[model samples]
Target chain A: MTAALEARGLRREFGHVRALDGADFDIEPGEVVALIGDNGAGKSTLVKALSGSLAIDSGELYSDGKRVTIDSPAAARALGIETVYQDLALAPHLDPVQNMYLGREVMRSGLLGKLGFMDHAEMKEKTQRAFADLGATVRDFTAPVGAMSGGQRQQIAVARAAAWASRVIFLDEPTAALGVVQTRNVLDLIRRVRDRGIAVVLISHSMPHVIEVADRIQVLRLGRRVATYDAKQTSMEELVGAMTGAISQEEAA
Target chain B: MTTATEPDRDAAAVDEEKPKSTLQRLVGAQAFQILGVLLILIVLFSIAEPDAFLSINNFRNVVVNVSILAIIGVGMTFVIITGGIDLSVGSVLVFSGVVAAKTMEALGGQGVGVSIVGALAACGSGTLWGLFNGVVVARLKVPPLIVTLGTLGMALGAAQILTGGIDLRGAPTVLTDTIGFGRLFGQIPYLSLIALAVIVIGAVILHRTRFGRYTYAVGSNDEAARRVGVRADRHLILVYTLAGFCAGLAGILNLAFFSSTTIAGQSNTALNVIAGVVIGGTSLFGGIGTIAGTVIGLFIPAVLQNGFVIMGVQPFWQQVVVGAFLIAAVYVDQVRRAAASRGASTRRSLFSRFSRPQGARRKEAQ
Candidate 1:
């Protein structure tokens, strides 16, 4: 299968620190890939670059093999790319529908233009489907997300990504603070999207989770891709070694 | 054994819960507190001065005077709900009046359509000042309090310059009498209805719209709002702009009521507007407020002032009462914040019941 998303020689510098150094990644369509790294390993830098939240000093990106530069977060979103940060971008005081429709609401039919209003009914209907398909049971759809469980809220964020996006998704530590059930739910969601021909790049520190959901894994160390492996070929210890800059070919010799 | 144990317990819990009645949940909501306070205040005032406090004439007088302040306070509620304040509103009010007065003067105050043109021109100037304060606060990332304070002086100076540091006299009488005295809904003063309409509209905008939700979200936690892709600064700019426009409206109302620009009218307008917002129960620190609360707050001082004047109470006592009210409201707000935070921390575990699976697992395992 052709790569749905690819990053070539991506380099980013943040003042005195080099966050990314010519990192290259290629994600095939319908693949669940984990971009694994320890803290400060340029995982976020890569994520931002892909999501159009940060600029790269050098490199090229391709969505569906067409070269592209993400100008802004909105631009990235427009190109069927969505990123759910570890700090989920869901607004607490707003209901899931409102949070989902932030910056992009379905405008209702109106006359004289004065009656312009949000087409909440349509948004609610679409959001409900995404939640139901994902097996998220939100008892109160109208409850402000602040009142929802963390897992349920995460589901809403994922649902938001899934509903409005079709090409690729970046999940940043999606199960970091989730319960076992929620972890299972999110892992299942990862698989479901891959089944639908969508490419997913999941960022996670959890070895077991990466092993379970990812079809491929790319480990980053000190702003470089230390290694890439088939999910089944990698072990937790090996990944850990790569992350901590140990167990390299030179180190082994 | 696990199934038998869980099934029996689950059934019992299901029977016990029945998904909680809507009324019970609603009665325990945050908005209920406002209703409770309003009821209590009504009862207390009725008992404190039965004849005067409950009279129709006194009520009309209270509403007419308070309407102007409430008109501005309602907009301030939106600004405060976004974790921002617009102190320049008073000066914006003065500035707007000067614009209207000049417009009226330029029209010679006697043309067939001068009132219409002057009203629009005056209100537009106020809107512009509001937009200025909003833009500076939103785009410059300045602390709203500081920006508004700066604009307050600037707006006042501008007003002085436009009117040449003197009260603009002989505002068109038609606009003045109509705004201040014309009956719109049966017998109520037009100003009172206008204030009511503005407050009602503001309340709907704050409570019902996506913009309203964003304001509350920004005020509650700005980081969370930004993460949600909310243009926090942009929304804030709009909020202050809306507030400034409202301030201008207040200025027009004042000009129409007083029939001229009082170069110093705004010196106390900000004080009264902020005080009214707080008195109505909008937390000074932000996140929670209501137009309904502000409306009540605007009336409290107006009614008190009217009552004192009628009862032959010392005029100085009006100032004293207002000052005391300010102190008390702010004190209550601080206490309420403390209590709310404490309650939240204490109730953290209760909410984690389903919200965080990890927390639940850890708690269960423990």
Candidate 2:
């Protein structure tokens, strides 16, 4: 099967620091691929580059085997890519429904739509359906997402990306701040999203979670992809060794 | 583990379906609370001067006088909702009125044609100033307060230079006669009617339109809005420009009502409108406010001044009262924001429920 998203020789630099040095990545359609790295390992830089939030120094990206350039978040979105950053990127003052449809609001029909009036009822209904489908417990649709608990906010951020992203969704440390139950819920949500035939790229530091939800694991060290392993076939020790530079696939080969 | 989470999920579902109580709903509504305050003040003033303050003529005069401020307050509400301040509004108003009055004088006509030209000149000048402010604040990345403050001085200075320190008079007899004092059916002043229309339209746009949602989103979190593909910079510029447009509109209204540019009359206008917007429950921190709240807030000071005059209290006391109210309103906003950030429901009083300690709120994963 063709990879839903593919990148080759991705390199980004910030003055003296090379954040991404000739990194390569690919994820098959409908698969959960976890991108693991130590601190300053270029996980976020790679994700940002792929999601069109940050410009890279050099790279080539392929979407469904076709070359594409994503220079802005909007461009990435148009190419059916969505990202949930570590910050969640939600307007704290807006409610869940409003947040879900922030830039892409559902407008009223005819004259009202032309005048930029949003169809609140339709947006509300759609948001409700999305939350229900994800089994996300977001009570009080009227309350601002900032006023919600961390877990609920996480669900909102994830659900928002899942609803709009038709091809691939990139989640950066989605479960970092979540509790055990919320983490499980998010893992289940990822599975359901994959079951819908969309690729999911998860960036996480937690090895056990990487092992549990990921079908394949890719490790980055010193801003380069050091190893790739079938999640079920690789041991946690080996993954940690790859991340810490104790085990280099290049040297082993 | 499944059983442990089941009851929690069920409880959340139940909570979602539970209907809000009347008191709860009332407390949640900031506008309603402000309206109540306005009504209580009205009652007190009426009781104090049954013959003077309670009369229709007094009410009509008060409303007519506040109509210009109300028009400008509509724009201020929008600006504040985006976490921005436009101190240049009063200056923009003065400058626009000067330009409009000059245009009407040069046209040398008291006909409706002259009035139309004068109104356009006013709106055009105001829009230019607004666009300038927008470009500076949005694109150049200057803080709104400083940019508007600089423009405030510049705009007022430009008006002074254009007129050479004298207020321009003679605003076309047609404008002053018809739009200034003309009453609808011999009761409502034309100025008040125009202001009312602006208020209604402004309210609808802010509450029911995508433009308004973008305003809130940009104010709430600029970076977040941008990340979601919102053109935040463009939106900020638009919002500031809208404010300038409103001030310009108010400038024409001011000229019609006063029959002069009133260059020196609007120095306190920006502060007064900002006070009223805050009193109406619009947060200075942005991302929350309403036109209705601003109307009620504008009335609080207007009514206070009108009441004190009739009640034999010095009307200067109105400033003191308004100043105190502004601080009180902001304090309430801060407290509410604190509670909200803590994930507490703002419907109840802060001390009503004992919140869990911060560390305890985050449970460990099993």
Query: Highest TM-score among the candidates is held by which one?
Result: 2
Q: Which TM-score value belongs to model 2?
A: 0.93
- Each model's lDDT: 0.75, 0.88
CAPRI class of candidate 1: acceptable
lDDT of 1 by residue, B203-312 (tens): 87887666777788788778767754678888887888889889888888888888768787568888888888887778677776777778777766776677666666
Q: What DockQ, between 0 and 1, does each candidate earn?
A: 0.33, 0.52
True contacts kept of each: 0.20, 0.60
Tell me, by lDDT, which candidate is best: 2
TM-score of each: 0.85, 0.93
Model 2 chain B: lowest-lDDT 10 consecutive positions: B357-366
Candidate 1 regions exceeding 4 Å error are A112-115, A179-185, A248-253, B1-31, B110-112, B162-166, B209-214, B217-233, B279-287, B303-366
